[model samples]
Target: MAVQENLLLGAKASKNATLTLVFLSILKGVVGFYSGSASLIADAIHTSLDIFTSLAVWIGLKLSMRGSEEKFPYGYYKADNLVSLFVSIIILFSGVELVREALLNIASPVEIKLQGIALGTAVFSVIAMYALSQYKFKVGKQIDSQALIADALHSYTDVFSSLIVAITIIGSLLGVLWLDSAGVLVISLMIFKLGIGMAKDSILTLMDAWLDKDSIERIRQNVGSIQGVKTVDEIRLRKSGLVVFGEIEIEIEGDASLKRVEMLFEEIEKTVKNEVKNLEHLVVNVKPEKISVMKIAVPVLMQEGLHSKVSRHFSKAPYFIFIELENNDIISWDVSENPAAGLEKKKGLKAAEFLKDQGVNVLIAGEIGEAPFHTLRDNFVKLLQMPEEIEDVEQVVKKVSELNTLTAPTE
Candidate 1:
């Protein structure tokens, strides 16, 4: 929408330039005919061409502004390029005619009348062309309108060409007859170059060429800066007249949820729109990448015989396990897979006293009831309950240790 608005603004500016040039061309033509000055006549003709080219630009802009249709799905954006190409050809032909006339004048020089009037008109035309060219150039850059830029170039060249003619006319009045024809030749060459440049640019646009490398790189940097985007896989840009359409493919972490990916997409769109002035359309696709998860061992304190019970049901037991001593002191206690029942009561009391003294923070066991759970909780010992039916003490112990690590307090 912003792109469309800018295009409209350019169209309006072009229309105004056309109207002004047409009025100036009529005035110049009347004066040139009365003065019989070839240079003024040539200037009038160039202004007339500008008026015609401006009309072409206005038509092209109007057509390009139309919405997409069934017959032409991409809309009429290329029409502007086509008009610019046609204008370039016309300008080129005008240059060729001017050159031909210049050659003839060089061969058979004629004294032109009203040198003062011709010089004055050329000076006024230069001032007008300069003002109009500056206006078009400024707006063309702002809106990214190639047609407007081409029109501005035409106006700029006219300013130089008219100034050259003015100098030639002044020289002719000073009896330097050859300068007039030489000036025309120089102006012809400049106009030819402008025509060729405009034509080449229009052809490039019609061919759907990509934008500049720097522009693509800037877009890549902007999209990559978005959070959750791991990398940019591919980017494509298509130019239609002044507007640009972009397609971007990005890679993101596989573990990143759908909501996160959506946020990244939104961010990318906003970033592109804000950064690139002529960006008309954008499509974003996200590709996910898989990552490995690492596992680590964690220590946890449990009631004495609790590990034994868990070991009896499950295969694994905690490593570097600690228990309370009989005197309520904490101590590292190791128990084999199968322990004798004779030491059960002593071990349980010792484990409790040791945990109490060491300030063992949490306990994990299988199926502890509310009464015992509350007792552990009141003692400031966090208890985690596991399912009683699951045997395999090794697996249970590993799972309990993993959970404790994840929820453990940091020092």
Candidate 2:
């Protein structure tokens, strides 16, 4: 669901960028043709390429939005990176062509008519480019969208190129033919540099490089803040257009219960999802520490007499006697509770059998019926029988801990 949301946001942004580029390209082309300015014409071509790149981005975003399948379990996220690479190649080729044309015009310059139509068109193009650049910039930040960022760069370059053409047109009206071609050459170089940068970014994303150090640190801090988590072992991040994929490893106590670990992971995942807008994937692994021994308290259920008997027999071992009174009241022998008012067993010997199967070492009670006694003895449970009149449950616990004998006769 999160991935779908991010993809939808990216797609909407891409569509807006595409429409802006198309409109700007048409406006620039009309202005350049009427003015007969070579630089203006070159800017129009660059704007056209922006339109094409935006379309590519839209298609890539759509493809990358697909959910994972058995054949492609990781989804189509790499599609966006590949499309960026394609866009870079297109930009590079267009830049080379523009440079070639500019060099030719430089060698043999053409006179351009600096008419009102041309000047007015350049003004309109400049305004549109600036507006689109700002929009793209704002949307890119909101979505953390790489495609929109690229579109913003394209618009920014268009603004600079349009301004240069405006200057060249003004210079040409004053009879400076060289200025027009020179501006085109400069624009070509800027476009070429942008192309190279986009190519490098695409390749790096395809190679699955980690995200920035600052982002990794931030994720580590957030994950470490979760309760029960001891430390963050590692964080792996990858990008596909606007989406971010993260895999985290956290260290927790070896003896921590599974429920605690799951809760910690859930908290971290939720924090990252809420904090990072474009987070599409998160995987968490908990590594436990090695330990030689683990001490855990095990609960046992038995009647009052059987509890006392086990407590007396295993007096030297650590144990607690739980007595079920007749009224469904759970009175612990470890507490000062009367044996006569012991709680009734809601589930009978079945419950004790279940506890025995769970590896409980001792059972303390006042008395047990024949059926339960035979069951406990068969399961090798050390039953300690308590006095019927004894009211202090705490004393029963101390007595059992001090006496170290077994209720079951020695084989």
**Which one is best on TM-score?**
1
TM-score per candidate, chains pooled: 0.68, 0.68
In terms of lDDT, which candidate is strongest? Answer: 1
lDDT of 2 at 12: 79
User: What's the lDDT for all of these models?
Assistant: 0.70, 0.69
lDDT of 1 by residue, 302-348 (tens): 33432433422111223213343332322334433212123534433
Overlapping backbone residue pairs in candidate 1 total 14
The per-prediction CA RMSD against the true structure, in angstroms, equals 13.4, 11.7
For model 2, residues 1-411, the per-residue Cα lDDT tens digits are 465666677677678877877877787677777767888889889988888887877787788778889998878877777877888898888889889989988988777874567777777888888988887777667766666677678778888888888888888888898999999999989888988998888788888885477777787888787767788998888886677788888888645566887788779888777656677778888887532221111233333433433332221212334443322233432322222223354233554555465454466554445555567677656665554444455444445544443354321
